[model samples]
Target chain A: MITEGRAWKFGDNIDTDVIIPARYLVTTDTKELGKHCMEGVDAGFSKKVRPGDMIVTGENFGCGSSREHAPMAIKGAGIACVVAESFARIFFRNALNMGLAIFEVPGISGGIQDGDRVSVKHDTGEIIDHTNGRRFFAAPLPPFMQEIIKAGGLMPHVLRKIRG
Target chain B: MGQTITEKILAAHAGRDVVVPGEIINVRIDIALANDITAPIAIELLEAANIPSVFDREKIVLVPDHYVPNKDSRSAEQVQIMRRFARKHDIRYFFELGEMGIEHALLPEQGLVLPGDVVIGADSHTCTYGALGAFATGVGSTDIAAAMITGETWFKVPESIKFTYKGKPQKWVTGKDLILYTIGDIGVAGARYKAMEFDGEAIEALPMADRMTMANMAIEAGAKSGIIAPDQVTVDYVSRRAKRAFELYVSDSDAAYVDSKSYDVSEIEPQVAFPYLPENTRPVSGAGTVPIDQVVIGSCTNGRIDDLRLAARVLKGQTIDRNVRLIVIPATPTVYRQAMAEGLLETFLAAGGIVSPPTCGPCLGGFMGVLGPGERAVATTNRNFVGRMGHPTSEVYLTNPAVAAASAVLGRIGSPEEL
Candidate 1:
């Protein structure tokens, strides 16, 4: 699957604490969560985002806590993919397991500016920044993960696996 | 091949000789835990599972610590749900307010965890027990419920990272700061999918409480758990608190480590995380004086007797700023008693600081210590993310107990030495 969007920039260590504050952890509804996404760090973030927009961040994105709400809120907010220098392990796995597109592009922070358009493929490592006309390499998703992403998250994937 | 502590525990629970990293396997859980905030959701999930009873009622530990004594009607309802669940499931370890502390502290102090066990709790700080040589990790409510019904959960054996501290810390530098420095060096996720083993002279020289603080934040760094080889201090601690004996083992010299790093303890300094995130930390001196509305000296990360004593020492005979509200919470009931015995509570009370019953209260922003819009606090709790303590507009600055106490006196975020 291909996704393209304008970029929303965040610096290093954009933790789950900032992505979705602990106060909103009471609900599991992604839409309710998306409204609060990044509201802690930037109160207007939810209002500024549009469908298919991407987030580009510095190293150590999604650090602190294994709150599943973080990625759910981001994906629910209609972000296409998050390109970061690095990702916290649980967040990385959880994001991938949930089929949320995240690219680990070291030093990619300097390459993109806010409002730049970018494109990504879930299976391929191809990432295209149309605004700057810059291309970056990313690790390719494994075949199994492709299925998981296509199925739309771990729950559906697990359901399919169990049914089979 | 030599097996590390995590590997050994995973193998034992898997009923296999050895388990490799990145491979997922379902293993039997020796214990399952939940605090008041999580127990309700976990119980709901448990009911959804349609299990007549928990796998082993004795294995489930419930504590109403987050908002014990009930912060508000909503919080009280959550506690009541947990209480009912515990009663129906025959969970004998349901701890009430005056009887509770932070779940992590109370578990180890009450002899509930032992070496080489696989334990899971709904609270992220559950990883704290790994300091005692148990392979414990935190999970969500559903996972905890699954464990309650089946006594099993899936885990991907994480790779191991070894950190060695070379020298003694300078005066005023603490294990709390060392953890911050290490997190800075590692960039928050360097130890992802890994178990970090703290070794070398510096960690050995530190007290068990400080070691627990170190192990506690390992999760923040994307580690499976952080552990230090249980030494004489560990043995003494277990002997004093636990009725049964535990066999603690150090990782073999040849144990495999996916990554290894070392630090100079003497170079470490007091660290502070600004209004944004825990990992966005700088040395305390680098951060200019920051205005504060409150100072909190408690949480699973920093609420202990040593932490309280340090804060009390700073507060003794010194009045806090009229604008500042300094709050202290002991990690457990035992720590509260110890502090009371030592006159620390009296000192704090005299200083105009409120001492709350031990719970995750302010840390998870569950009930107590909710910051209002535009309010800023210098807190010893982990994760200073904006709105983490309460209102989305409120800002939390993370620091150690000493700095928190000093900030309370100054009515702003400042280092202890500055005071």
Candidate 2:
């Protein structure tokens, strides 16, 4: 089963730099790191985020450097998942490897808004946005990836598989 | 049913007669790489695996470029670890700063990589080798660890796009402009999970440097890799550098491509990427006025000898605006020595630009060129996203070295046409 969240809208090509600035890369503590999420692009982002918020946006949503810190900071900041029109290749892998929830919703950007509570069923491509009680369709996660998410990131997933 | 250069190579490396798109296959690597910024962590992971030695010591090439000349102890310590690792494992090409340059530049220049081979590097720009008709990609440290231990890794074959070019470039337009134009048309994610193959008479006529500039920036378009089939230019370059002769690969005329685009370069002009992303681009003529505090000219992209020579030609006898501080770093020490011997250093210093050692500094906001809050600078480095070069609010305008040099002279974003 997949967890659901309220929507948090962002614009096109919301790069990794806007998600997490490089200054905070010195530490690996996710909690202390979440405080600075989106601080680079929007200083008010931290206070504005509520638990269970999901980010929705346009293409190349993580288009800059290959720093895994970008996804780590986002997942750490209580973002349930990021459903983008598309994602940069490195960011896509990094997000999955880190076990942060993300989906590719090719045509759903025009159908969503901020503060809209949405329940995403990853296996069925079902999306329930509570604001207008609308249902939107998206690509379902691949079975292999779903298993990885179930185990919570690549490391744990690898450990579980290897040990089993 | 046609095979791409990447597909053909991966199939050959995997010992298969043929491999198709979306099919997974395990292929042996011709080369595995890691630089200073990525090597230490990858080496740490490899050590944890408790392997006695790598699958083959000579197959690994360790180059220290990003933090070369060792600005701080932490970076210096990382270099020391890599050196010890290389020495202990008998790694053949462990290039130090003075002996090394950019890994991408050094790899081909030293003839360590060849066509139709599978190569992996811990750094993303490793895809730069795709220009030589190889199947190359970047992976994480753990993946590199696996490759080190087993000498092979699995990949799902990618579809490819064919980019056909026609027409001669106009005055003052360089390869950087053409690539920026291509990225603009494709946006940032147009080529995800696909390879891009450059073809036709136009791509054929381009110098090797131009082809490399195109392949180097292919990642900015979200492509897994971009390549041009090896032609006379490629063969000559490889032959001159490699002690042993190597074969080249080409895509079939009827090869399948998910998409294709064509360009005529006669209308091209100098290009610049605005304050945030590589895709945030505009022609220099369309790039309107913006003030700046700093200027930079070095990175894996646009940090070669040709880049410096282009800047030097524009700033030969001129002085930069008194307010702007310009920083110029050669891509490799060899490039530095060449620039010095050619007196490019004298021209740069005379024009008020400060020269730093070869490192990927300022490109990642790691060291040397950190931006102050609200201060904007025109740079020749890749990526202008917030905080990419330092403070988030400090804007960066990405341009070729020529435009960067001109902007440094004018104290704001301007064109090299004036110079």
Model 1 spans > 4 angstroms off = A1-11, A28-30, A44-58, A75-86, A92-164, B67-69, B243-245, B279-288, B372-375, B391-395, B412-419
| DockQ per candidate, 2 decimals | 0.31, 0.34
Candidate 2 CAPRI category: acceptable
**Cα RMSD (Å) between model 2 and the true structure?**
3.1
Tell the DockQ for candidate 2. 0.34
| TM-score for each of the candidates | 0.85, 0.89
| Models, CA RMSD each | 3.8, 3.1
Tell me the deviation in Å of residue B202 in model 1: 2.6
Over A1-164, each residue of candidate 2 has an lDDT whose tens digit, in order, gives 46677787887778766888765654445676678888877787766777767888887788765656677688778887888888887778778767677788877787888777888876666778888788877777666667766776555554454457
| Tens-place lDDT digits, model 2, residues B367-396 | 788898999988876678778788877888
The true-versus-predicted C-alpha distance at residue A102 of model 1, in Å, is 5.9
| Fnat of candidate 2 | 0.29
Choose the strongest candidate by lDDT. Answer: 1
| Model 2: residue B365 alpha-carbon error in angstroms | 2.1
Clashing pairs in 2: B276-B385
